[model samples]
Every structure is written in C-alpha cells, then in structure tokens.
Target: MRPGELVPIRDDAAPRVVERIALVRAAGAVPLVGDPRWSASHWQQVQDAASRAEPDPQIAWAAVTSGSSGRPRIVLRTAASWSSSFPVIADLLEAGPDDAVALPAPAVSSLTQFSLAHAAEGGPRPLLPRGRALVAQDFAEATVLHGTPQALRALLDAEGSPRLRAALVGGSHLDPALRARAEAAGIRVVAYYGAAELSYVAADHGSGLALLPGVEADVRDGELWVRSAYVAARYLDGPLRRDGEWIASGDRATLRDGRVHLLGRMDDAILSASATIVPEEVEAQLRTLPGVRDAAVVGLPHRTLGALVAAVIEPDPDAAPSLDDLRGAAAAVLAPAHRPRRWFMGPLPRTASGKPARAQIVREIQTGEWVRLV
Candidate 1:
C-alpha cells in the first residue's frame, strides 16, 4: 500500500472498528481514525505527514497525537506494542470473558481505541457510547469503565455512579477531590500516566503512580524516561527522543518512595524573574479554591520577566470567585511568585481528548481574545 493512501474510520462500533484495524494491519495500510468534528485541514495535515513518513514494514497502525501542547502529528505503532499490555490491563481492571467493558469516548481517541482493542480479546462486545454523556442504562451491565477524568466525572454527576469493578482514568491529571467523590460513591478510580508514544507507563489507586510490571522508568534531569514493549515504533512527522531503548517522555517528575510523582510537562514550565513554576502544580491548587470548577495556568510574555504566570478559570455557576478571593486562597498553598498575575474567568478550552489546550489558550491570551478578569 502507498504511504499517503488513507483509510479513514468513522464507525464507532466495536466489532467494526476491531475488524477494520485487523484488516489494515494485514494490508499494511495506514489507518486514520478521526471524528467528523475534525476540519478538512486536519485531514490534509495527516495526509501530508503520511507522505513524509519513512516507510516501515513493521508499522501496523498510525494514530494522531493529542495536540494539547502543540500541533498534532501521526504516530506509528506495531500491533505487538499495544497488544502486549492487554492481559496486564485486563487483570488490573479485573475483566473477564463474561464482563462488559464500557468505553465512553469518541472513536478517534486513543483511549477509546485501546479499550476497543482490549475488548476484542474475548470479553463480550464492549459498550461504546457515542459521546461523553453516558446515562445510567449505559452502565447497567458494564463491569469496567475506561475514559478520561472529565468523562468519568460527568458520569458520576449524571448517574450518581454505578457499581463497577474498576474505573481506569487517564488523558489528564486526576484531581484528588474528584477521586474522593468517586471513591465515596463506591467506585475504584485507578489513575494512570501515559502518552501517545508510550502506553501504560504507570498507574495508581491511592498513592502516586507506580511503574507497571515489565516497564522501566528513570528520572533524568527532571524529565521522565520510559522503556517498555508498549512504546511506539516511531513518529510519522516529528522526532521521538529515544536513547536506544529509553524514550524521553517530555514530562517532569520525581521519584518518591518508589512511586512517580509527575510535576508537569517540561514544556509547560513558567520562568519568572526569580523562580520557575510548574503550571500543573498551580492549577491543582487553583482547583481547590472556592467556586472554582476548573483552572488552567500558562506563562504570558512579559517586559521584565521572560514570562509571567497567568490563569484561566471555569468558575462555578452559582458563585464566581473573585480575583482577591482566589488569590487569598491560593496564597496559602502557592508561593508568592507562583500565584497567577493575570486572571480570566470562563470555560477553559480543551482538546478532543478533554486535555487543556495550553498552546491555543496561550495564543488566545496573547492576542487579546481572552478577556482578563484582573
């Protein structure tokens, strides 16, 4: 098959998706699974990337990276890279042949595709909801749930949580308060850390994420490096930093008590005149403030400092927290330099996978598209 030739998948059915994946692998054709929500330009970019990709007979599939921090690209992976972890993940979720796995996400998302591939192993055909809004009836027979933290939170808020063996949550940082709520409702929330290139790096039940079995992880110069059978083969457009078997994760983390505590993305660090601040850390504290539903922190260009910390918050509908109130609350937990210098109140822009679109938000803020609250 030609490199630029595309096999677009729009069907969300589990069996159909599974069959198509198998067929593409057999034919050595690149499969592009994109939702209709993607613009025509996005498809064109995928085609362009495919044309530039070096042909690799070992590549079984291609998936678009979630462009939360920057532009999206197509990543190449062999079937074994993902299939090797099915048994481990299934065991973690306690899935059995008779159990029904429910994946409440779009078909294009990597998490949904992974769930579908796992379900194809022997379990009863999985239940795949069209969108994130899942009703109580959707999980009536489901034994396991797999989705992002936002989707799981929506499910809990809508249906008050259903009985499940386990809930595997990923794609973004899992807020401690949200996990507490889910746990209080009798649902086991397993938070995982992974990326498009590296699958199933680490997971945690209550403590920090511990490296999965058969996975090797090391922290070097404040960045995480992973080596495992589940690592992707290569990137179709950009370069993946791989030193032999180790793949640089581009994430900053710390090893504490044999568990991985992720600080944030190395690229998301904010440099001020006096110190460096990690946005994820500040955002976590911001989320705990009164009347704050969600928050995103980014560094804006400044005259004296190279960059200044700024924040965008999704305030609660009933009560919107003022800048002074938020600052007062954050002051207790955050250092003086870490507090947000500029504040905007509104819904944070997110990507298809429900991750905060940091690059796009920064651009909007720089261009005056986002109104400043302070």
Candidate 2:
C-alpha cells in the first residue's frame, strides 16, 4: 500500500502490519507494511485507536484536508509527499535537534508537523490533557511553543507564563495586535501559513511571511497558488487542481517584496449589497483597538443585503473597549461598506483546531443563539 493510503482495519484489528498485509491482499494492492523510522508499536497504537473510533476502515488513495472546508477529515499523503514538505519548514524555522518545541496540538494534524518534524525528538515533549480549564503548565519547558491562535490566546489568558522565548502560531490568523502583545510580553510570536495539502509554504519569519525554502508562492486573479515541496498527493475525495507544479490554494494573498500577506480564504468573503468584503480585513482593524483580546468576523444573512458583516469580539477583562468606540474606529480606517454593521462583544467562537469557527458563528446568527449586535 502507498503511504497515507487508508486500509480498512477495524478497532479490533491485531498485529497491525500483518493484519494490514492481509487487508491489502484482500484489496488487491501490495502493502509496504511499516516504516522503521517511526515506531511500529506507536503506529499499531494509533491504528487501534482509529479502528475503535470507526468500525469501517474505508481506505483511500488520498487523505482529506479538513478545517478549511469546515469538516474534520484525513487527506492522503505519501511518505514522499510529507518528506517533500519538510525542508522548507525546517529552513523557515531554522530548526535542528537542539531546538526543543512545545506542541499543544495533537501530533496527527498536518498543522503540527512543522513543529513535530523540526523538534527531531518528535511528538509532544510532554502531553498535558487540558482539563475543563486551560493550565499554564505546558509552557514551562521548551524554547519553541507551537499553538493555534486561539490556543495561544487562551494559554496567554490562563497561564500567561512568559516562560517560552518564541512561539509559532498557526491554524488561524495571527492578528497583528496579538502578535505585538506577544512580542511586548517578550515572546516572539510568528504566524506560519500552511494547509494540509501544502504542509507549510511560508511563515512570518521576517516582517511578513517569507516563502519557505523550496516553495514558490504567487497570486493569480486574487487567488493564491503554491508550488512547493510540501503539496499533498491528492484529496481522498478526488484530485485537487494543480497548475504545472503549483497547487491552487483557496486562500487569497498579496506578495510584497519576497513575503506574502494572506487575506482570508476566498470562500469566506462576504458579498454585501454594495461590495464584496473580506471579514479578516475588518477583524484586523477591530483587533487594533484597545481591550479586544480576540475577534472573529463573519457574514450574517440580512433582509436587504445578502450578508451583513458582524464582529464577534472577546474583550480583555481588565479593559473592555466600548462597542461604539470600536465602530467609530472602523469608520475612521475603513470604507462605508467595509465596516461591520453590528458588533457583538463576547467570547469568540473557535474550532477544535483552535481556529475561529466562522461556520459556527453563522450558525449561531441563523439560529438566534448569538447575541444581536445592538
């Protein structure tokens, strides 16, 4: 079987390699069995956990990359596929065996591979299952801390342990203000960019995100395309469009000098009555104001306009900025159509990956569960 090819093994499957061999035989494909570099026992444990979770193992040639599409699913990757993506990540982070990094996210996610691969020791330096509340214990060790933006925010709130010297924030947008705060707090937070398909293409290594070594980034008609060592083989569902060596990334980006400034994903853009608006643009402006710890911008259905911009902000407890003040600030910096029509101040919505859940925000707005902007 090819690397990342799903072999249907149930939770009760045994002797993983041997069982997988049999399964592959049954499926009429040759099986590679195991890789010595990563632990077989660990692989068995992972397989067992996966089987227990899902009774039917419908193996596929490719894996699905979720989160961007709003569903958690696996995408296919070959041993070569992942290998092609690693060097750029290593070069971007300037990583080596000496680098000790704390990865709060699970090792399974493509999102965490940059941290996992760079650390060399691999896996969680120490896994601390977050209880009902986040604890600061995780950041006590390791020079590099990798977490999603929300995870960083919560960790900063719960522990704020300024222990870790540098951070790599991913799986969501890193607001400039938040990045500034982390810098001010003595933790250098750099926002890295990648999707499951392209493990890591670029990161904010300099003033803006620098394209990782072995990666090519360019924008076409406002959509971003990445030709890199890291692009995945294919999606489990189907093949993804590729232009020559480059993969069509759904994200929108602007390449300035050698760095790229990412706008939000193209699908997330909201078309109001007057014009199309990117919520991130509005969110970025809102985040600059004082008292806004975290923010999520979403398009909610409106009677007249197809969608109205809504700002859901998590206010800092110590100093909360007034809603009117936020609106006024938006008015000064943004165009009339670009400003959010309503502001909802509360704890922001987030996904399991620690990225803001725009889908959840839309759902809440539709169901009237979310607080109305007054």
Every candidate's lDDT: 0.74, 0.59
lDDT of 2: 0.59
TM-score of each: 0.68, 0.55
Model 1, poorest ten-residue lDDT window?
65-74
Residue-by-residue lDDT tens digits, candidate 2, 45-117: 4344334432123322222222111122345554455555545444544444555555555433444433433
lDDT agreement of model 1 with the native: 0.74
Model 1 lDDT per residue over 194-296, tens place: 8878988999988889999989999999999999999988787656799999999988999888899887768777756424576777787788889999999
Residue 260 of model 2 has an lDDT of 85
TM-score of 2: 0.55
TM-score of 1: 0.68
